[model samples]
Target: MKLTIQRHQKGKSYEETFDVASLKVTTLLAALYEIKAKMDESLTFDAGCRSGVCGACALRVNGRETLACSYTPHDGDRIEPLNYHPVQRDLKVDKEKPQETLKRVLPTTIQNPKSKIQNPPLSSEDEAKFRVQTDCILCDSCYSACPVLAVNPDFLGPFALTRAWRYHTDPRYIEEVPNDSIQHLTSKIQNPVLLDTVQQNGIWDCTLCGECTAVCPQQIDPKSDIMQLRGESLKAGYSDPTLSTPSFGTPDFGGGFGFDPNAGF
Candidate 1:
């Protein structure tokens, strides 16, 4: 089998093809190792854990974001680094940008008097809200798949927003005060965390393209989480300027591409 790898160095990128018909290369990662070991030792890629749990082996396989450790290779497969980040080398991206964004969001319990109180029994519903969100491996596949980042770099990407939503919906964060009912959790903190997501380049900026969900190896749906965050933001009196009054009876207006539900188009 022949593998074509797109390599980058210093600011220039070029493709290098390697024939590994003699090597027992099944997975893409194995094929990459074979290339480095047998053909060109300069071939570069990222891999860790090799089991798909760490998400360190992320790459664009044949134009789709995937983990190289788990993807089976075929004839003439094209492998490259993820998009929306600076390429450090051949098939390796500088994750500092996404890592910094994730750090900036501080996806943790907002420090507040209420948040540090004695543990209250959490209802199943409360636990269920953030259950799936815990599965995020921070692979950045969704980050690469996001179309919004292509246009708006300032927009906080999906995983960060999903973590924000996870923290916001946390039982402790949204729970009522014991005695006199207090303002929402956002009002208590000097800097309400959720407020960060309602700004100009926040939840409103999300196109709901579903690409994030499509590429996630953890199966976490950041798109749905963003929608939930939008609802929470609405409760907080924030509105997106892009939203407008519904234009009914117009088939072309916002009708999704596919078989029309109304069957008029």
Candidate 2:
């Protein structure tokens, strides 16, 4: 079978084709290994825990983000590095830059006094709110598939925003303190700093195109997480900055068909 791979070296990009003996159950990662072992020793890609748990082998196969360790290769499959990330070499992208966005927006620690007493109690019902988001492996698949990043590089991509929602909605962070308390526990209000951080170039900026959710190997829906974040932001008194801009250019004539634009009419 013929497999074409997009490669980059010394700041130059090119494509190379290799012929491999295909088996019925051979995965794309195995095919890459075969090519590297016999065909070209210089072939480069990332792989670890080839069982698809490590998420290190994620790349674009036929212009779609997928785990190379699990995806089967076809006769003319084209493999390339993930988009919206700096390629370190052939099929290996620099994820450090995109991963840093998590630190910039999410709270570093849960500030619940109850955690000091005991591991803050979490009910199954509360856990259901953000449980799916915990499956994120820090893979750049959603980041590569996000259309928002194409327009605004500063916009916090899907994974980061999903994590933000996870931390924001945690019951431990939202518990309120009792007025007369012997334990001296303080109010565990949600982090205001996080709410402020996501207001700009963040949740409001995402187009919610669902592409991020489509390509996720974990089936984590970042699009839905982002929508929930918007609701949380609204409850926290943050309005969409995009809505503040005038949609129509008609003059406001007091009460005659002139409604307040800031009211979101």
Candidate 1 clash figure, as a count:
0
Give per-residue CA lDDT, model 2, range 125-226, as digits (tens). 999988888888887899999988888998889999988888877766633322434113222336555666787899888888999999999999999988
Question: Candidate 2 — worst ten consecutive residues by lDDT sum?
Answer: 177-186
| Residues 107-202, model 1: lDDT tens digits | 345334554456676789989988999889878999999989989998889998888877777767543233322245345432254554346677
The runs of at least 3 residues in candidate 1 whose Cα sits more than 4 Å from the true structure, single-residue gaps closed, are 107-124, 174-192, 244-265
Model 2's alpha-carbon lDDT is 0.82
Clash tally, candidates in order:
0, 0
**TM-scores of the models, in the order given:** 0.81, 0.84
| Full-model lDDT for every candidate | 0.79, 0.82
Number of the top-ranking candidate, with TM-score as the measure: 2
